[model samples]
Target: MMKRLKSRLSSIVIAICLPVIVVADPIVGVWKTEPDRKSLISHIKITACGDKFCGRILSAYDASGKEVQTPNIGKKLFWDVVGEGGGKYGGGEFWVPLINVDAVPQMTLQGDKLLVKGCEHAICAHQTWSRL
Candidate 1:
């Protein structure tokens, strides 16, 4: 049980060191998403937006990791995620930029990575975003 204990200890330290508000909200930060079909990756900044969580594309990079200019930059990637505790969040709208559709989102936090998924009926997509 050392792993579990260590995990608890680390969480306790995080709770003690961070401000009450910051500790309560663990998703406030920049996250780098996995590369898309075109091998393009984007940095999403998650923040509190009107009592919910919203993510916007802060920047995008090409396959070679070179920053590129695009009109879609600064667009909203997702919004309206409500925290459900235990590292779970839901009730958000996630944008499918490729198909130009919006889908319901579900998210789970795992340490420094966030598993973000979007679903519409039987269709779904997910990405693992690393904290930046």
Candidate 2:
């Protein structure tokens, strides 16, 4: 019947468009990073870049919560990050501003927190960032 054919076509259309409708990844947000060795905190803004994701430092603050001017602001902290499902992401490069080096990065999203880790050879470090 025509009604049955039309219903099947509608189902197919929805199935094809579902992925596009849900294109926004949960990782897209502003996250507050843990204080570094200098006791400075950074707020990173994560956004969609092509099919992957990228994060940049939006601002920085001192230990007393006063916003400070830092050259690292507006710098790309991470890029080419791809979500691997189950709240895990990897395949990205992380920039360590303090050390002026790059490392392989991995991330995991848990509720309002994000665990970001970077490894260079045998050395590894991680920081927990809270969503703001």
Candidate 3:
């Protein structure tokens, strides 16, 4: 009877601890920025940079849909992501080297909308990103 009780207790402990062991999905995939008719171009790609999450230009095209080469390829797009509890990330700036603007970019994934908080140099463009 004591052995059977011990087995049941072990099973209960494992069941209780299983949820804590499950980790959230890592945000290391292609993401597309929300399109804008006013802006000439828009694109986004969230990639893993060391231990941080960084974004890059995945696609930039003119109105004709032709691929355009972006100037900010190797720049640091974002950082300080691990502190935001996995899905929420911030503490970095997003910039376009061709354009003269760098915004304090904070992003959170909710459903299919990646809400981005943009604020830098008096220019803010709140963009919603979609996973690609």
**Highest-scoring model, TM-score:** 2
Question: By lDDT, who's the top model here?
Answer: 2
Model 2 scores worst on lDDT over the 10 consecutive residues at 15-24
lDDT of 1: 0.89
Better of 1 and 3 by TM-score: 1
lDDT scores for all predictions? Answer: 0.89, 0.92, 0.63
- Candidate 3, residues 1-132, lDDT tens digits: the string is 999999999999987665333323345566666555534355666665545567766566676666666665445556544437756877766664445567677777786668877677676767777666
lDDT pick, better of 1 and 3 = 1
Decide which is better by lDDT, 1 or 2.
2
After aligning candidate 1 to the native by TM-score, how far in Å is the CA of 21 from where it should be?
A: 3.5
Model 3 steric clash pairs: none
Error of 1 at 6 (Å): 41
Of 1 and 2, the candidate ranking higher by TM-score: 2
lDDT of 1 by residue, 1-132 (tens): 999999999999876665555435989899999998778899999987756889999999998999988777999989888888899999979998888899999999999999999999889999999999
- For residue 42, what is the lDDT in candidate 1? 94
Please list the residue runs of candidate 3 whose C-alpha ends up more than 4 Å from where it truly belongs after superposition.
Answer: 1-26, 36-38, 73-76, 96-99, 121-123
**Comparison by TM-score, 2 against 3, better one:** 2
Model 2: runs farther than 4 Å from truth? 1-23
Kindly indicate the candidate among 2 and 3 with the higher lDDT: 2
Q: What are the models' TM-scores?
A: 0.81, 0.84, 0.61
